[model samples]
Target: MSGTGGRTLLTVRGLAKRFGGLVAVDDVDFDLDDGEILGIIGPNGAGKTTTFNLIAGALRADAGSIRLRDAEIAGLPAHKVAARGILRTFQHNRPFKGMNVLENLLVGAHRRVRARPWAAALGLPSARREDAALAAAARETLAFVGLGDHAASDVSKLSFGQGRLLECARALMGEPAIILFDEPAAGLTSVEAERLGGVIRGIAARGIAVLLIEHDMRFLLPLAHRVVVLDRGAKIADGTPAAISREPAVIEAYLGRHAGAAA
Candidate 1:
């Protein structure tokens, strides 16, 4: 279900990306509202990932405007975009190799740290206080994602599902205005995916926008407030899950003959 009475948080207009002669994202435009779950779905080579990369600032858009609260963020570097309150998770888990779960989460909060380098290096009281506060927040975030018990566990010791949850917790450490999830349900058992879906719903309930790209309709359709369907690098449909399910273009281009069964 869509969040009601929320303001628009992110806007993309005329967004386009090209690789040599291939148009990866063709003049795409979409709006993400605060506390909303917006899903992007398409078949392979449909430019979903490319669109995600552009929004996350991992890739520059060839032509378009990306606005975060009215500020143009189209060509900002990934770190800058992150600092501006846009964070993302990968399709695969990317835990910090040597860090424990809590420590890995702390790393995600680096952009939020306000202490000067010298202050931290000298162990000044302000830096120490900030460190303590951030650590506390990290713990809170881990608990939010159902990973509280694993705070001290080595990242390598985590199961695949736990690692994915860790990634979500880490992203939360940044206090993002929007979190971009790339194929979040991939490689998870049904139970794990169901749990992750609940966590995502909680995230939106807290007023953070969620942008999701996933191939798993069973996992995404019921979770998203709205969905954008892409075909051949262009959006073919954009609406509520039920509405999208009935879109003729979407069915023909991406869902195929068994669209009804899939829906």
Candidate 2:
């Protein structure tokens, strides 16, 4: 997809990875444009998740350049990468199950705490100020997902759809400019999907870029400004949803699963 005024938000160049004898990702080159809803569509085992892993620092790339805002960040450690504001949600909604939804969101704001050791230990004025800020932010995030009243609920007790929104909220707590969403619509009912779509648009309205990797074209086409198709770890097409939806090569590669995969 074309970036915001030709500005590249993320650049992946010559990215290649191998696991034992399997070439999971093969010299893939792509870029995510600024503030665009870019959908990544692919079949099972097309290295979609692996690409996310490498970008988020869950795995080290054997070869490539990962540049965020034009600075090289390929080999950085996970925490360092996160500190750089590139955040991601898991394909699975991996919440901190033992904690309440509010607590989970608070954890995402750890990087923002400004407290001295003694002040925090004694619950001083500084600690109170920071805590108040976090509490307000957490509530706002929950409200964005239509769960402000359930902030105290245990994440383990949330319904499947609520849990997914909570997962997204926890990531949003970081206030990141870019977030990678792995199948945000998976397992959601029509109503839930509609809500999720609104949430995604809200995120974009805040000028945050979303790179969505989803299997449901029905859910994606309506929201995505552009789409990218992958097959066996290679990009076959990158264009607007209407154009990509009509490509025969994309249809053949993604067959029988995505909405137009069988076209």
Candidate 3:
């Protein structure tokens, strides 16, 4: 959907993906405007994750158009898609186990670092300057995601919730225009999930669009500006959270299986 100024930042039209004879996604269409949190929900085996893969360039679309601001990016490689300012966090955290929190974030800033291998090998002043700047930005992002104190800690030492925060911190280091979160609340306790909700709102306040795939309606409903429902590889409904709650098709597709969690 369009945002405050009627600007569409990301658009997916007639997006279709197939695996063998199975239609994983069928003619799905959606628009994510600047600074909006659009939640995607569905039952097991639904095309939620596949749709994310298509949009993030982890998978190619069999038929459709995926656009970022007017540039087509349907089949670009993941790195190229990331360079275009679309970054995604996984359903499970993927921190570099041997890397410290700060180091992991620096990896995410690779595209922004201007120093080439030769410059760094020779210890050029420009290389040193850029490295220092990237480090500073990483630290700032860690603080933004409530991981400031963990900058020096080993990734292996973080709890599940802290790891989730670290993943978000790394995404922030990339300075993406939009972030795709895949089941961000999956393994957290209620309190931790509540905290993540706050972090997501903080991210949106910075004018970044967020498209999240979450099964926790309790967490997703309040955090999302809008919700989209999918079932059997097709969209069933799209509306404000309240409207989605009462949508009969959504209820039949999702609530029958997830009503208790959403209760």
Candidate 4:
């Protein structure tokens, strides 16, 4: 499933959100295809996070539409959005402090292990089987993100880079169709950032669409199939990564403004 060749899996059009008189997102539109890695970049206060919130249902849109596989989901709650196979990782990784890495991932897989209340309460065979399957999946995901050795370690004890990997593992436990990554490389050393980039590519190779909001241009430009640039609250450019780099409006509004760093 090539990024541009695949069928459209998500469509956002005229998406707008406002806080008082300040428009955070204004009439933005974009499409994400199956197996695509779409990057969203903009200067500070460009409404990148607000766009994510609207799509994830953490914030309701004041205007516009969001469709997931033809189903309207713009106004749904966060949990409802997750039920539709969309998951996200925050810029700040927030693993359960009291839980081990494996246990934290188990919480992510809870949605898939559908044991009846009675079955769980009675500690029936079905519940036991479900628990085992979830544990296996969690372990597999931990290994995939290169955190297998830390599966039994306390989450609070993990380094910042390890915590980010752990967050990705938890997201994978859900087996989501699309994962939204908000600055996955923030605060990482160069080596750690390189490792995170590989993990992201591995995820896309598995045919999951990725929508990344990141400020690291070096990391994002080479990885994304397409790049969308936002200035203020509106989309200024959307095209192939190469095309986005050469776009004059993008250069003038964003890239040129942050010439030496992320745009």
RMSD of candidates 1 onward, in order = 2.1, 2.2, 1.7, 1.8
Separately for all candidates shown, the number of backbone clashes (residues 3 or more apart, or on different chains) is: 0, 0, 0, 0
- Estimated TM-score for each candidate: 0.95, 0.91, 0.95, 0.95
What tens-digit string does per-residue lDDT give for candidate 2 at 1-263? 47344467888888888999887888888888767788888898888888888988889999999999978989899888888888887767778769998998887787667787689899899899989998898999999978898988998988888888887787788878689998988889999998889888888777788899988888988898888788888788888889888888987777445545445
- Write out the backbone clash pairs for model 1: none
Candidate 1 lDDT by residue in tens digits, 63-136: 99999989999999998999998999988888879989999988878876999999999999999999999999
Q: Candidate 3, residues 1-263: lDDT per residue as tens digits?
A: 55334368999999999999999999999999888899999998889999999999999999999999999999899989999899998878888879899999887777778788899999999999999999989989889888899999998999999999998888888889999999999989999999889999999888899999998888999899888898988998988899998988888889776876555
Error of 2 at 183 (Å): 1.5
Candidate 3 yields a Cα-based lDDT of: 0.89
Q: What value does the lDDT take at residue 227 in candidate 1? A: 95
Better of 2 and 4 by lDDT: 4
lDDT of 3 at 119: 99
lDDT of 4 at 65: 97
Candidate 3 steric clashes: 0
